[model samples]
Target chain A: MKRKPSIVVVASSGGHLTQAMCATSLVKRDLVLVSNKNMLDGSHFTRVYTIRDTQYNVLIHAVNFFVALKILLKERPRAMFSTGGPICLPFALAAKITRTRFVFLDTMSRVTELSNSGKIIKKYGLYDSFLCQWEAVANDSGAEYHGQAFDLGDHGHQ
Target chain B: MVKPLILVTMGTNDYPFTRLYNAIKNDSLYTDNRCEWFIQTGSCEAPVAPACGVIEKIIPRADMEDLIRRSALVISHCGIGTLNLMLKYRKRVIFVPRVAAHDEFSDDHQLQIAREIKNQRMKVVFPDDQFPLLDYEQIKEDNKLSDPVDITNYDLAEIINQKLTG
Candidate 1:
């Protein structure tokens, strides 16, 4: 049997996961989710890997780095993507070290600026492609803006 | 016949959103048995349960989706997940963004996103603003709605797809 290459998506459970799913809806490659919480029902991703979630915890990030490396080694994905809530920080580091193409989409929740994890990844030059959902935010940060993950326009109340 | 359902979600983050819970408790509809309420409180504690409904910490994603489908109006934290669902289902929504001042979240990102919200069906209640009184007529009106069009921005998804696959 042959193993298919996958695109590993990193995001937290709430809005980050929603944006990631919306943003990656067009991807034809096998989608594998690397989320901090396993809230998903496996309807979307080929596989789901849970990792310790953190924004400011240094030790957890360090541990998740190895977990990321292990998953990358096993999957050897075609690329990596994230709509971050800081849980993707270690995965970003691992993607750079493993030479996997990494695309980071700043979460739509941060309307005014890049998210904290996005700022860290951007500052460290860890991503292959960077995008922001907000046009003004993208303009300010130099990230690609291709509109939001979903339409905010009302559809006349169902 | 089932009563009109109101779903209140505070997201899955570990913040205690007592402010939202308190506001709902103080509302006139809190003790109304004609309507049903399911409040997913996350870490927020509810000392006084609703007279007619229940409060829970968290629920499965599928359960939440079902609740959203049945809900006439959704009182939600300004989390994008709930916003996406409300928009997808075209539910009447009251968005109360979690603010940093009250330790509802680590930062004011929810408020930031709340300000950018321009959806006619959705209303954003700022920290200074009071949670609007639950409107029974609108809830009953919304309960009649059926399916809504899918609103995912595939244009953005296509760009993202190209960035990853190209």
Candidate 2:
């Protein structure tokens, strides 16, 4: 029996988690959810990895990097789909080092420009595919337009 | 004893969006006391101002959903969580962005979100703007609650499935 390839879904809690789950809700393969504690409801994730909520703190970020690294090594996901915040940075880097495909979806909130996370992902050349919710900004950034990237109705249930 | 429920949330973000509460406290609505206000303040300390009604540091998800369902009006920071809740229920919402200069968020992402929402013709109030009651009243009169863009069919799961398989 072969193990199914895993996809690690990463985002900050709250809206980011909701949006990320909207995208991940359609996945038929193995999936792992990562974020700060108490951010998600129910048991949608195969496994949950909780990292410290690093609020622009350098030390906390370093801690998160190691935590992400450990999870990535253990899960060995083939791809990472992230609707991001500070957490995406560590996962993006880990995905890169592990040769995992990285996907960064610019939050729908950003209309004119890529979000700070999107900017950083681009700066480091981490994302295998950079997608935007808005076509105008997608054209501006030469990224693919993915229709609308966020949906409120998606409660992560298939 | 029954007052219209007005839900105020700064979302689950750790930063304190005190400005929204301050503006709401000073707004004419705060003095009325007739309206029952339920505030989900997140990481912000309990407000010193007595004007802010029923403050919950954090409400459980079930209770939050219930509150959103029952509330007549929602005043929220420009977080996607609250935005989705408002839009999902088609609840009338007043969006206030948290500013970085005020030490609320590390960046102006919420401000950007607010501007984009305003561009979409939703009512959004900035911090530097005059007292928000006038606009709030105008929105109440207009009673315009436009459904957000239809994007529910765009499935993230399907996208990932295709990428991994194809």
Candidate 3:
């Protein structure tokens, strides 16, 4: 049997997590999800890991980084996907070191400026493919704009 | 007198009105007796009310859907959830983007969403811009406005399936 590509979806709580979940419906492979405490529940993931809600602190970030490394080691995911925020940082680094494909889907917001998370990812150039919601943002950030994957016109309940 | 209930939400994270709450309260626009204003403070500290026509209600996140449904008009921050709810319910929305200058966030995604709303011909309010606070009659007029897009017709699962598998 052909081996399926393993994927890990990472994000912070709330909108970023929601956007990640919405995007994950497209992947047809083994998946593991990691997010902050707030998004741990009411999610569809075979394996879920919760991290502390640390927006921008080095101490909290270091802990999350190690935790992510541990998870990545155990899961052996072929690709990592994240919407944005601090949680994605460690995984993106691990993906680079492990030669795993890191796909950073810039969250769909803020047309004028790149998100802080997007800026960090761009600075490190860790993303194998940086997906964006709008072409203008992608062009400005020098990332690949995949356009909005979410069917915003669709209001059907999930 | 029966007054139309105006629902205002500034989203889950961004609270641009936190500092401006006091300024708004003192303004005659909010203090004038015309309609009842019901504001939802997602996670921010509640604003002190000025003696006027406004009534503040701090709603938990769980109650957002119910309140949106019952409201005659929704004045909300430019968040995906807020936009989705307004689109889904086909409700009249006067959206205001949260600005970074207000310490809302490090970036300005809300402003982008607001721009998109305006492009769609939907009613929206920009932050730092003056707005004639909607009265009961205006709220009704706003609801009668049509949104250019019908979000219900598109299939989200199909889109996701195509993107992931192909």
Candidate 4:
């Protein structure tokens, strides 16, 4: 029996999470989501885990690392996708050790310099593909442009 | 007759323009009791003077749409979130980019966004090193100079959808 590839989507709250959700709709595989914010309400996930919001404090990062390690062992996802933030750190590190494919999408906010998170993950060489919203960011980061970068769009009243 | 209200948002990220808050708190421009100021701070600790003639309220993560709907002018940081919200709402806006040297961020990318907005002839403000005190009336008048470019979310959705499906 051919097993469907397992996929894990991870991001911080707000824009990153929103961007990841956009990608989730197109993925037709076993899916899991991990985030630091309670932004996920009524989300479709095989499992959902909340990690400490890493906007402040390093202790949260240490805790999330262990949590990610445990999740990696249990699900053994084939690929990991992230929109760049502290929450993606643990998963990126775990993917490196497990030899799983890791994809990093630099947020649209950075048109020139790599985001702080992007810079940190760049050294790992674990990222199989680095996706960027702007061509300049891809050129500057030395990552192959994945193309078709999306901006969050004009704010529409819900 | 009531004056049109002006909404000011600095977004969730704290910028180094704390001085702007202090400058407008007790300014004579707001003393006329004609112009109303609706300001949202990124932090609860933002030092705000008591309401003199204009109303001041501290809203933590308030709805951007509500703020824009009730406002005639929007003063905001050069962040994309705020910029997109203003454009989405079709409100006349003035943007002030935070300087990187002031520790606003690790880089000065906001300046790049600001330049892009300027190239489009959108209303934007880039403070000189001196952080010159701005006249509210002048800022309000400058907003009428340009027509905002229509940047829609449909394009964004289509692009992401293609990437994910492809």
For model 2, name the residue pairs that clash: A23-B156, A23-B157, A26-B157, A27-B157
- lDDT of model 3 at residue A51? 77
Best by lDDT: 1
Q: Candidate 3: where is the Cα deviation over 4 Å? A: A1-6, A28-32, A37-48, A98-100, A151-158, B1-5, B14-16, B19-39, B47-63, B119-121, B138-166
Stretches of candidate 1 exceeding 4 Å from the true structure: none
**Per-model TM against the reference:** 0.96, 0.83, 0.73, 0.69
The TM-score that candidate 1 achieves is 0.96
Candidate 1, residues B28-54: lDDT per residue as tens digits?
888988788999998898888887888
Give the fraction of true interface contacts kept by model 1.
Answer: 0.85
- Deviation of model 4 at B9, angstroms: 1.9
**Interface Cα RMSD per model, in Å?**
1.5, 6.5, 5.9, 6.2
What would the per-residue lDDT of candidate 3 be over residues A91-131, giving only the tens digit for each residue? 78877877777778787765666778788888989887777
Q: How would you encode candidate 4's per-residue C-alpha lDDT over B90-142 as one tens digit per residue?
A: 56666777667766654677787677663232456566634334465754543
Which docking class does model 4 fall in?
incorrect
TM-score winner among the candidates? 1
Chain A TM-score for each of the predictions: 0.95, 0.88, 0.87, 0.85
DockQ of each: 0.77, 0.33, 0.24, 0.21
- In candidate 2, stretches whose alpha carbon ends up further than 4 angstroms from where it belongs are A1-3, A151-158, B28-33, B48-53, B118-122, B134-157, B164-166
lDDT of 1 by residue, A71-143 (tens): 9999999999999988898899999999999999998889888988889999999999998888998999999
lDDT of 1 at B13: 94
True contacts kept of each: 0.85, 0.35, 0.21, 0.12
